[model samples]
Each structure stands twice: as C-alpha cells, then as structure tokens.
Target: MKSFDVAIIGSGPSGASAAFELSKSGISTVIIEKETLPRYKTCGGGLVFRGLKMMPFDISSVVEKEFYAIDTYFSQKHPCITTRRKEPIVSMVMRDAFDNLIVEKARNNGVTLLQNHKVVDITFGETQTIHTTEGDVTAKFIIAADGALSPIAKIAGWKETRTIIPALEYEVEVPAADFERLSNDARFDIDAIPYGYGWCFPKKNHLSIGVAVVIKTNKKINLKEYYAAYLKRLGITEILKEEGHGFVIPVAPRTDFFVQKNVFLTGDSAGLADPLVAEGISNSILSGIQAAEAIIESQLDPEKAAVLYTEKLKTGILPEIEKAKVLSYHFYSKKSFRNIILMKYGQYAAEALTDLFMGERTYPKDYLKSITKKIKDAIFF
Candidate 1:
C-alpha cells in the first residue's frame, strides 16, 4: 500500500485545488480519480468571475469565452436588465479541460495523480486505508472532494441532509448566425420554469443551456418540456447537434458533522454549493483551500484541523449560504411580490448581483432584516 499524509478523492475543482494547495505546502498528497484526465463533466460551464479569480495561475488557455455583461429576463411585462462591468462577469470553459488543468498544476508540484482508481471502500484507522479497485492507499487524513453523490461521505457515516435539486443541461450547436447572435452575452431567464430559472451560457463552439428549480416541490416538473419551450423562446429553429444531461445539485450543506475520525469532507461532498444560484465551483475551491489551510495550520493534528476547518466554514462559507437561502426563498417563492420589487429596483439588484459575481461584494450577514426594510420602503415610500 502506498501511504501519504493526505488522500483526496475526485478530480474536480475541489479535489484538484486541495491537492495543489497541499502539495505547495510540501504535504504528501495523492489525488485518486476514477476517470482519466479531461473527462467531460456535466455542468453549465459558466464560471462566475468570483470563481475565476480564485485560480492561482492564469487559466486563459482553457477559458472558452468571457462576458463583460449579463442580461437577465423575467416576464415580458418586466423589462430585461443588463448588468455591465469593467471586468468580465463570467468566463466559460469546458469542465474537462478546466479541471484537468488544476490537477496538472498539482501534479507538477509533486502531488501523485492516481487515474482510473475508483474508491470502492474505506477502512478507518490511525492511518486511513482507501480501498480502490486498483489497490489500497493509506493516508493520515482523507479529504472527500467527490461530487454530490459522494460515496465517501456515506461510508464515513453521513446521512443525506443536503437539499438536492434537479437540473437539465444540454450542449447545443446551431447555425452560424444563431451562435454568433447568442454567443456575445451570457443570459438568465428567471421564472422560466416553476420555482426555477434558465441560463444560456455561450461557449467557444456551442451553447451550454440549462434550467434548474431551486426549491423542491411535490409536483412533478417536466424539465424536457420546459427546455423545449426555452429553446423556442430563444428563437432557436434548428439544432445541428444537441446532447442532454440530467444531474442533481446539492444547494445546502449537510446538517451532519464535516469530519469523522481523520476523514474530512469538502465541496459537494460536504454539500457546500451556493444556495441561491447553485454555483458550487467558487465555494468548492474555497472550502478545499480552507481544508488544506486548516490541516497545515494544525501541523497535521486531526482534531485541531477539524475544529479549525469548521470554524473557517462558519465564518465564511456557511453564513453566505444561509443568507443566500433566505434570498433564494424570497426571490422564488413569492413570484408576484418578487416581480413587483424587481420592477421597481431591478437595475440595482442586477448591479448588486454583478458586484457579487465580480467578487467585490458578499451576501449580507443580516439579509432578512435588510430585505424587510427594502420591502417596507418599496411599498410605502
């Protein structure tokens, strides 16, 4: 068995990032990935500016497109709001290349990359033994950076407490004119689906389009029907090539403990996706870095690292998600009232969202109080 100080599962942004940080600090790290490098990942591929800025090295090589403005559309009654910025608001990329780039960086820094190694089971002990199909590898700590359906989390005695929402995405290619027309700007259509929103993210060659319902309901929502309607709304007459993928997004954190024994959970494994937008890349990278830092700061003391990691999450990631939950509820649940508020102050809200995307702002600590005040002011004054 090969032994290391830390073993990280998955090769997405979270795992790659943790490996990169840990290897930079001279910690023995191994990234155990089930697939080969540059495997296609199902996602919108819209990397917000905030997440883009988290990259330590330049990723221009893999970036497909960068948009300086974002167009948001609601019902026809409410006008579309365009938010602009000096810097690009969102940069698009295919996840296969983007994720592989990060993992390569870590590998260059001496992190072992174990491709085609699927973790089938985990044996907990002083040194955790990760049993993969290929073989067994041991480590002092295990960082589960695997995605929403994290088997490691379940093996570590965690229950399903995260709010998992369904989403459908398609990689679509159209005529030159349609691609050129829609490729210039990133767009979002709120209320495109019941309790959800739609996004059209232009890539280098095709358009990555999708719709996701934030809040789960008892009603059976047909995403395909809505997707077809959305395509018509976009004026898309012909589709040269289209591939659809269905996946789930974990928008809330698990109520269970983050660390058990020496195994630590990060990113989707810990259910750290942004509650409002379902954007997990930024927080995934952040949580990965935080976990690495906690381990480093504690000098490899598992107990101390666990406490420090939880503290770091509470201070930053958790609170932001909580506030985002409040915002998402208000924005999606009360549709009529939300439209009213947007009709009055849509531009400001769009600008605020752009600022957040640019990493210049954060979700306010007391979002409910602020929202109430705004509602009162909007209604009376």
Candidate 2:
C-alpha cells in the first residue's frame, strides 16, 4: 500500500479543492477519483459569486455565462420580480468542464491523481488504509468528499438524514433568432410551478433549462411535462439538441457526525447543501477548504483540531443551513405567500433574498419579522 500524508476520495469540487489546498501547503496528498477525467455530473451548473471567491485559483477560463439579472415569476403568465444586480451575481458553467478544470489545477499543484479508481473500503487504525479498485493506499488522514452517497462516510459510521430534492435538468439548443430574443442580457429566470420551480440558465450556445421538486411530497409531477410547458410559455420551439438528466440534492444538514477519528466528511456527504436553493457547489468547496484547514490544525493539535472542526460547522456553516431549512419549509409550505412577498418587494427584497440564499449573510430574527411586516403591509395597503 502506498502511504501519504493525506488521502482524498472523490474528484468533485470539494475533493479537488481539499487536495489542492493540502498539496499547496507542501503536504503529500493523493486524490482518488471513481471516474475518468472530465466526467459528466448531473447538476444545474450554476456558480454563485461568493463561491467563486473561496477558490484558491482564478476560474475565469471556465465561466460559461456571467449573469447580473434575475427574473422571477410566480406563475407562467406574469413576472413576480425582476432584479438587476449591480455586480455579477452568478455564473453558469458545465460541471464536466468546471470540475475537470479544478482537478487539473490540483494535478498541476503536485497532488497525485488516481483516476478511474474507486474506494471500496476504508479501515482506520494506527493509520488509515483505503481499499480501492486500483489498490489499497494508506494515509495519515482521510477526507471523504464523495458526494451524498459517500462510502467513506458510511464506513466511518457517520449518520445522516438527507432530504433529497429531485431535479431534472436539460441543455437544449434554440434557434439563433429565438435565443437572441428570448434571452435577457445575461439574466436567469425562475418560474414557480405547481410543485416546484423551473429555471433557465443561458450558456454560450445553449440554454440550461430544468425543474426541481421536493420528493417527499405526494405530488408526482413529471419534470419533462413542466419543461415542455416552460418552453411553450417562453415561445421557444426550435431545438438543436436536448438531453435530460436527473440528480438528488440534499436539502437539510447532516445530523451531527461529520468527522470520526481519522476520517472527515465534506461537501454533500455531510449534507452541507443550501436548503433554500439546493445549491451545493459553493458550500461543498467551502466545506472542503474548512476540512483541509481542520485537518492541518488537527495535525498540530489533535484535540484542538476536533474542537475547531465542530466549532467551524456550528458557527460557520451550520447556522446558515439551519436558517435555510426554515426558509425552505416556508416556501414549500406556503408558496403563494412567498410569491406574493417576492412580487411586492421586487428587486431590493430579491437581492437581499439572494444574499441569504448564497449564505453571504445570516438570517436574523428581525429579518423574519420584517418579512411578516411586509406581508401585513401588502395585505393592508
């Protein structure tokens, strides 16, 4: 078995970010990926500005579209809110290219890349030994960033109650004329459907259109049906290419155990996804960096490292996720009220809501009170 200072499983954004951060600190690191380079991942491929700021390197090369406006619709007929941001709020990119770019950066930074290697089993003793398809490898520390269904997390006996949000996304090519007319100036639109919402994220040549709905509900609405309806609403008929893919996004935070002995879990494996938007990429990257930092700190002082990891989650990420869960419950429970609030508040509220969604600001009790006031004002006024 090959031994190293750190062993990272999975090559997604989280894993790659951890590998890069550790390797750059001169720690011997190895990354094991289950798939080949440039693997396709089922995702909406949207990157918020705050997420981009957390990366160690520049990613301008991988950005597909820079959107500064958001158009939200409560129903298919009318727009609820149209907000123009002063700065670039979000960027859209294909996951294959985006993840591959980060992995390549990690390789360039001297992290050993074990491509096409799947980690089957992991044993923690004096050191950690991971059994992979290629071979077994040993490391002083192991970081599990293998996503929602993380095997490493399972082996470590980390308990998680994941709220899976089923999403079906597609990339469809529209005629040049229609694309030009229908597409706003680098803006993304969100249309609230019966069970969930539909979104349109424009790329270089095609549009990333999708719908997401909560799986726990009894509403068995087909996403493709919504997609067709969305297209018809937009007056988009001609399509060059269309491909639909579905993936599960965890909405709630994991219970408690994200770290065990010599193992640490980051990203979706720890259920760090944003509950309000179901966005995981930024949170995954942030958690990975935090995990790497915790590992390094733990190496210096083991007890302090463990304490710091827990503290980081409690003070850093968990609070935001907790607030998001409440917001998500509110949206899904009383969607009409949420829609009316968006319509009445318009862009200022949208921007603040966007900040809340991106985890840039904490949701205070007063903010919720203000929302209630707004609802009352809308009713009375």
Q: Best TM-score goes to which candidate?
A: 1
Which lDDT values do the candidates have, in the order given?
A: 0.91, 0.78
Q: Best-fitting candidate, measured by lDDT?
A: 1
Q: What TM-score would each prediction reach against the true structure?
A: 0.98, 0.92
**Which tens-of-lDDT digit does each residue in 121-227 have in candidate 2?**
88778688888889999987888899877878778887667777778888888889977875664333444445467777888888888878743567677777877
lDDT of 1: 0.91
Q: Considering only N, C-alpha and C atoms within 3 Å, which residue pairs clash in candidate 2? A: none
lDDT of 1 by residue, 1-381 (tens): 899999999999999999999998999999999999989999998888898888999999999999999999966578889999988899998999999999999999999999999999999988999999999999999999999999999898888999999999999999999999999899999888888899999999999999999876788999999999999988899999999999999998989789997888999899898887888998899999999999999999999999999999999899888888888988888888787777678998889888888889998777678767777888898
The lDDT of model 2 is 0.78
Candidate 2 has a TM-score of 0.92
